[model samples]
Target: MAGVRTSLRRSAPALLIFAAIRALGLVTLILWSHAKGKDPHQLLSARWDSLWYVRVAEHGYDFTLTAPDGRVLSDMAFFPLLPWLEQGVSAISPLGFADSGLLVSALASLFAAWAIFLIGDLLHGRRVGITLVALWGMLPVGIVQSMAYSESLFVALSAWSLYWVLRQRWVAAGILASPAGLTRPVGLAVVAALWVAAACQLARRNGDWRAAANRRMVIGAVLAPLGCAGYVVWVGLERGSLFGYLDVQAEWGNGFDGGVAFAGFILDRLTGPAFLAGAGLLIGVAVAAWAYYLCVKQRQPAALLVYCGIVVGLALCASGYFGSKPRLLMPAFPLLLPPAVWVARARVGVIVAVLSAVSVGSAVYGAFWLNGSGPP
Candidate 1:
């Protein structure tokens, strides 16, 4: 217990810094939303991206929208884990649906910060942990931490699963990976990482797997697929179509095929010398390259590959939901750690002060300029 308390004390400064950054970002979001004629409470409960999550929490998956072309769109299109959490919270708390969702996300964001600290500590050290958590809190899209989004929840689950895997706790790793899958499609990446790690361990012993170990691995693998599979099954039963979720995504212009087509379209537009479009493209490419560089320099090749593949694949393959690119990239947060660590090492106070200023500005822009729109 003394050792645990000591460890917590060591991490306290990082956690406090992380909390301060997120709080500033949240304040900016609230103020900007207020400026936009949106009440803070209403903004918290607004029927935008958050509405689908609330609906699922309150009512379960009962609604369906069919396009004119007979395409069936099911509420099951949204994953179940987040809503289920919201439902659980509402059941126990006096908070209404919106407040419940907000509370869940807010707590999840803090959990994500802790998880980031753990992952960074494992990969680098306590310094890196502090830097990584600070960077996550200061990201331009960091407003998602305060929103009723699943990014924070998913990150918390993924990071903890990775930590468990690193500690060789196969059963715990598997259990965490399961809900991760339910949270987002990208949870499969965590599943894949765990599977690979487990397989390597098993193979090293010449297939002389212990019964207990084998059972644990099997459970982990099973858990990983449950969330996604359960959603599909529910959609199929309710809508009479196994492809109901896909169809709904299509209507939202988010079918997966490869982002090459969308890239081509964007390129064509840039060929016409549209200054704003060109500038946007340039910024996007620069950010992507910087992320890629961090991945390479940090020697986290596997994490980099997984994040790049998912982000690029989703961006290209989805039909028309290009607006979600920012949100989709939010999960590639591990890539940010290396750069943040570098920043922290170079006069930590200066770096943090700069980040705090930027976080506040970005949060304000997200709430007001973007209207809490886009993937961010």
Candidate 2:
């Protein structure tokens, strides 16, 4: 208890910084929306995927929307954990389903920030840890951290799971990974991290079958895949086919096509009128690649390396939803560690000025993004 209290006390500053960043984002959004005669709360709490989560929370899985092109967008495409939390929050509070989702996101994002800070502190130090959390909140889509979405929830679970993995708490890591898998399909990244870390440890131990660490790690490996598998298998049984979940994702035009569609889209943009946008995208990809290279150069833990690799690979390589790729990679927090370390190493004033400027820019960009087409 004393140790937990001490950790929390030390974590308070980082959490405060994270909370302030989120608040700045919300205030910027509110001002921008008001000037444009739009409701900021609605944009944040009930748009795009937010509506689908609300519908599932209120009506269960008995909903589907068909597009003019005859594409079936099944609510099944959404994982259940967010809706489940939304439902529970609504049942207990005066907030409706959408509002409950916003509440869930708000709280979850804080926890996510806490876990991010812990991971950074564990690997580097308190300064890098705090900067890592700040960098996460200053992301271009950091506004989504405050929105009624599952990204925050998944990030929270996955971050803590990774922290535990770094601490070699395999059972705790697996427990968190299970709910993370329930939150989003990317939860597989967490499971992979656990499996890989365990395998690495087992190899190091040279067949220590009776060790408690090995036993717990094996149990964790067994438990980590259950949530995702159970939901997918249930969906399959409901649809009377073993590949029903894949079919559902297919109908929605989502799949892993080795980035062919993504590459083609980029090339088309480069050749077409959106040449600048294409260049910007290429630069973004290059930046992400460089960041991952830095992570490898810094010798991040096997758990973090595997987790980040899976998240980045899936986000970049997955077919369809090209526009949502940035938001999809939101959970790949480890990618920010290198920048976080740089920021930590900077002078205090420089750190403050850069983070403040970037925070405002992120806020304005987020407002513009949401006020415009928004997350589709």
Q: Highest TM-score among the candidates is held by which one?
A: 2
Tell me the lDDT of model 2 at 97: 96
Lowest-sum lDDT 10-residue window in model 1: 301-310
Cα misplacement distance, residue 47 of candidate 2 (Å): 1.1
How many steric overlaps does candidate 1 have? 7
Q: Over the full model, what C-alpha lDDT does candidate 2 score relative to the true structure?
A: 0.92
lDDT of 1 at 175: 86
Clashing pairs in 2: none
**Candidate 2 lDDT tens digits, 151-174:** 999999999998988888989999
Estimate, for each residue in 277-305, the C-alpha lDDT of model 1 and write its tens digit.
Answer: 75686577568668767677667735335
Clashes of each: 7, 0
List TM-scores for all candidates, in order: 0.87, 0.98
Which parts of model 1 are misplaced by more than 4 Å? 1-7, 66-72, 211-215, 241-244, 268-274, 301-308, 315-317, 369-376
Error of 2 at 228 (Å): 0.6
